[model samples]
Target: MNGIKNAVFTDKSIRLLGKNQYTFNVESGSTRTEIKQWVELFFGVKVIAMNSHRLPIKVKGRRVRSIKGHKKHYKRMIITLQPGYSIPPLRKKRKELELKNTK
Candidate 1:
């Protein structure tokens, strides 16, 4: 897969942060080992475990005769890091979001 695309920060993911887990949206072709290496190298965190899931394709605008189109499917990874390790980008985004919310 192409490099780590982006991180997911939904309500569910936010709750997982308390347990030292992070969610990232990755290319469909990426492997678990690749994700582990990338996270360790980029975030300076020790990845203990990783789980990947493929989201189902979303179909829209169905016609009477046939289907219209479908949104592309994507892979997501949930990474569990060793205690005391945290990703700076994730923290920065969270802080920015909090500031936005407060204002």
Candidate 2:
């Protein structure tokens, strides 16, 4: 569980959802096996395949030009689940709330 940071939702990721693939931000040091195990145990879904890659580190600095640091690096994991299984969409609740407020 600690290895997984959070679910990732983006234009590309949302499209992958239709294919039963889920994306997540994981700790940079986490391996595919570790992430697969954690996701399966926590979500109770069967993971068929896992693909992971590290995202590029971003540089950050203060306006003073003297202080600079690199943002925390993380890995992105794409997990494909067995047919007929799925994790709930994270944006569903937010969309519902937004619709309610707009009405």
Candidate 3:
């Protein structure tokens, strides 16, 4: 990963903020603007809007073990693309989007 090309966005609050968009787990510190720029550059489509938020950290424990490990808190962002251009559903539409960001 170049790690600087800006591929993902991270914001947790976006989960309930968006009406028609989905959120992705990304770098915790990433911002909505950076995501919009990255999406625009990679997918060749215009980003209509974006929002980001931090998810509350939750305490977690190891499964079936006495040891405990804290689950790290992360951020995610919800991005809205132009109505006409959309990233197909990931489950059944992987191939169609496989080459989209290949470069």
| Best-performing candidate as measured by lDDT | 1
TM-score to true structure, per model: 0.77, 0.73, 0.52
Cα-based lDDT for every prediction: 0.79, 0.78, 0.50
lDDT of 1 at 25: 91
- 13-66: candidate 3 lDDT, tens digit per residue: 223223435455556555666766766786566777766665455336424322
TM-score, prediction 1: 0.77
Predictions: Cα RMSD each:
4.1, 5.1, 9.0
Q: Which of candidates 1 and 2 reaches a greater lDDT?
A: 1
Across 3-94, the per-residue lDDT of candidate 2 in tens digits comes to 98888867678768778888889998887888888988998899999888766553453233222464456878899999988887654644
Clashing pairs in 1: none
